[model samples]
Target: MGPITVTDDLARIDLDVVHRWLSTDAYWALGRSRETVEAAARGSLSFGALVRSDDGDELVGYARVVTDRATFAWLCDVYVAPSARGRGVGSALVRAVLEALEPMGLSRVMLATHDAHALYRRHGFGEPAHPEWLMALQPTPAASPATPAV
Candidate 1:
């Protein structure tokens, strides 16, 4: 594997690969649609980790942050390709993201992960300081336009 290069260039992303990885492999995004993925990328700050080979640069990892670029950010959809795991690509990606956001001096950055707690802890991510104060609502999926509501 070649040296990994992390960049925030959205043009460098291969949406097909990202959708495949998330929709098929990622637990949090299983069955997610390409249109949804595209929309998420469009609305978030995106990063891609690439490696150059004779075949040219290939995107091996991705992450996105939803933020107002001021006081709050939510880091989500972080993924590293199977071929790219165990080689520090994930760390590099997260480091680049935090570095890019440091200037904003955001009050908080947050993410939720079923696994990778240790990895995130290495980058200063911890359980919420006030979990009791937080609440979430996950609404049921809306009916499709073709489906009549009961």
Candidate 2:
């Protein structure tokens, strides 16, 4: 990794690159559709990591934050390409995101991760003090006609 450039420019993002990683490689978004991924990109502030190459620049990483720009921000859909992993791409992306949000004076920034806790902790993230106060409502996937009822 040489001189990785992280930017919030949506113009620089390649949707197909992002969708490919999210749908196939990312555990959180496995089997996710391109339409869903595109909608997410459209609705949130996006960041992209581009590395300089002899031919041109390549989009090697991505992250998006859904924020009200006043109160709260939820950081989600962070993915670094397989070739970009373990080379500070993830850390650089997180730092860029934090810097971007700093001007907004947000009350809190939150993210859910089954792994990579250490990476985030290095950037000042920690376990919620009041986990009991937090809750989620993930909808069950619709059943198909071929599926038998319990």
In angstroms, what RMSD does candidate 2 have relative to the true structure? 11.8
State the lDDT at 89 in candidate 2: 92
What TM-score against the true fold does each predicted structure earn? Answer: 0.84, 0.83
Clashes per model (N, Cα, C within 3 A): 0, 0
- Candidate 1 C-alpha lDDT tens digits along 13-67: 9999999999999998999999999999999999999999898999999999999
Model 1: colliding residue pairs: none
Candidate 2: residue 17 lDDT (0-100): 94
Best by TM-score: 1
In candidate 2, what are the lDDT values of residues 1-150, reduced to their tens digit? 678999898888998999999999998899999999999999999999999988688999999999998867888999999888999999999999988987786666777876677687677675433543221111112433232112
| lDDT of model 1 at position 137 | 15
Q: Candidate 1 — number of clashing residue pairs? A: 0
Lowest lDDT 10-residue stretch of candidate 1: 132-141
